[model samples]
Target: MPDSPKEEVDETGGPDLISFADMPDRLEAAGLTRISKQRCRQLAEEDPAWPVPLDKALKVGRMRLFDWRVLEPYFRNRTPRQGQRTDLKPPATEA
Candidate 1:
């Protein structure tokens, strides 16, 4: 059996670096991250932050690309763990 275009691997014997278009599914499958291309675009429009700048996407031709190694941490951190509250609570009101 031969590898499909989408499954092509690199010299490192890992999946080839992919374009932003392919990120959502790949990230989910790899258990590395979960972000839609649309969400990624939205993030790209926002102000920069630390560690991984969600908006810092690179362009190759007309396609946007992101390094999985760099993005994995951001996604992992964003994902809400089981039975854990990921949202912030409002401050207590004063009487």
Candidate 2:
């Protein structure tokens, strides 16, 4: 089957732009990280390394589209946050 409009690459020969709503599933389906829409939003808002959205200034809708090219690497190389590690032992208290 032919690709849909949503799947077409842009003139820059880059991957199709995607919204946060579909990003998590798309990345997960591609064997990347298992992320949520809320996490995507948080990363976009808090992560300095996040790619700038192509339509950041457009206020017409709540949809913010990002470039897949940049995001793919980000997700592929993402490491777990330090606070998420479970191997650390609690500090001993001196009596």
Q: Pick the candidate with the highest TM-score.
A: 2
Q: Give lDDT tens digits, candidate 1, residues 7-76.
A: 3345587634556677788778976656787766665555253234534556577776666666656666
| Residue-level lDDT tens digits of model 2 in 1-95 | 97766634687786567788888888987788778899888888888777674436223366777767778888887775845555677877999
How far off is residue 14 in model 1, in Å? Answer: 9.9
Instruction: Determine which window of 10 residues in candidate 2 has minimal summed lDDT.
Output: 51-60
What are the models' TM-scores? Answer: 0.51, 0.63
In model 1, residue pairs whose N, Cα or C atoms come closer than 3 Å (at least 3 residues apart or on different chains), thus clashing, are none
State residue 19's C-alpha deviation in candidate 1, in Å.
2.3
lDDT of 1: 0.61
